[model samples]
Target chain A: EAGVTQSPRYAVLQEGQAVSFWCDPISGHDTLYWYQQPRDQGPQLLVYFRDEAVIDNSQLPSDRFSAVRPKGTNSTLKIQSAKQGDTATYLCASSPGLGYSQNTLYFGAGTRLSVL
Target chain B: AQSVTQPDARVTVSEGASLQLRCKYSSSVTPYLFWYVQYPRQGLQLLLKYYSGDPVVQGVNGFEAEFSKSNSSFHLRKASVHWSDSAVYFCAVRNSGGSNAKLTFGKGTKLSVKS
Candidate 1:
């Protein structure tokens, strides 16, 4: 089976520009997540969805960051007016279900975004 | 609420040397602990997980971790490491009971295995 897939392995943009990342989770997986990983840091949760319904997004920078999983299979994370601090790798992951036993997430190669 | 801490930011070990990566978590309840490895641009991969039962849990590629409730730690260990073992390892924890729980990650420990 194919693993979680992310598009535009690399992306570069100027400050104040916008960029969107796309992700296709492992087939049949019901939970999807978007995380931002800064250099020398661990991946931080930005947003997540469970079958089309957002579970948590408090960590997401509401003013500029937004994410959606309309059909609950694929997800898109968008950053409006990107900042230099936004230069980080965006990772997408998916799980089989809820709870600890179902918490294993399969991740994609990630979208490396750079704001010039 | 739950949080994970990886005290070591970097660790270097010669090939065929034993290695251990420390991970500590803070949670009021019985939390779910996991260790993940990231290779350069690649995404994080599950190395091992601990939920309940025997403390020692083995994972892929000869990696293992022991969970200790008293210490609140889940440290990853390997009998011997190879050059391919070089990567960034992250320790994460999630509330075992919650409606919408998310895994909290640590700063990560970069292991550089020398041949």
Candidate 2:
């Protein structure tokens, strides 16, 4: 099976510019996640979905960030009026299901975003 | 709440030398544990996971990790490492039996293998 795919491996934007990232998870996977990883730091969860319904988005920056999984297979993460701190790699992951035994997540190469 | 801690920021080892990277987690119970490796400009790839039964589990590329319940630690070990094994290794933990899908990861340890 093909792994998760992310578009535009890298992006550079000026402050206050808008940017969007696209992700296509592996086929037949029911759960998808978006994470932000800064340089030299671990990934931090942004949002997640379970079959088109958001499971948790508490960590997401609601002011300028939004994510949607319209068909439950593909997702988009958008940042509005980008800030310098928004510079990071955005990663997408997918899993077969919930629970301990089924939660092995497969990740994509990630989209590196930079705001100047 | 759950968190992972990798005390070592970086480790240097020569080719064919034994290596060990430490990981400690904070959780009330023994949750699912995992070790992932990330090459430069690449995403994370699972090395191994621990759910139950075995304390020591083997992973891809001759990697293995031992889960210690008494110590709340899951340390990864490699008998002999090659230059290709040089990468950032992250230790992650997830609470067992949850629909949350939140995997807490440590800061990661960058391993450098010199020939």
> Candidate 1 clashing pairs?
none
Using Cα atoms, each model's DockQ against the true complex is 0.85, 0.78
Query: Candidate 1, which CAPRI tier?
Result: high
lDDT of each residue in A1-116, candidate 1, tens digit only: 99999998999999999999999999888999999999999999999999999999989999999999999899999999999999999999999884554678889999999899
| Fnat scores for every prediction | 0.82, 0.63
Segments in model 2 whose C-alpha atoms lie over 4 Å from true places: A98-101
lDDT of each: 0.93, 0.93
Minimum summed lDDT over a 10-residue window in model 2 chain B is located at B95-104
- Estimated TM-score for each candidate: 0.97, 0.98
Q: Write the per-residue lDDT of candidate 2 for residues A25-110, one digit (tens) a residue.
A: 99989899999999998888899999999999999999999999999999999999999999999999999874554668899999
Per-residue lDDT, model 1, residue B29, is 92
lDDT of 1 by residue, B1-115 (tens): 7889999999999999999999999998998899999999899999999888999999999999999999999999999999999999999998786665588899999999988
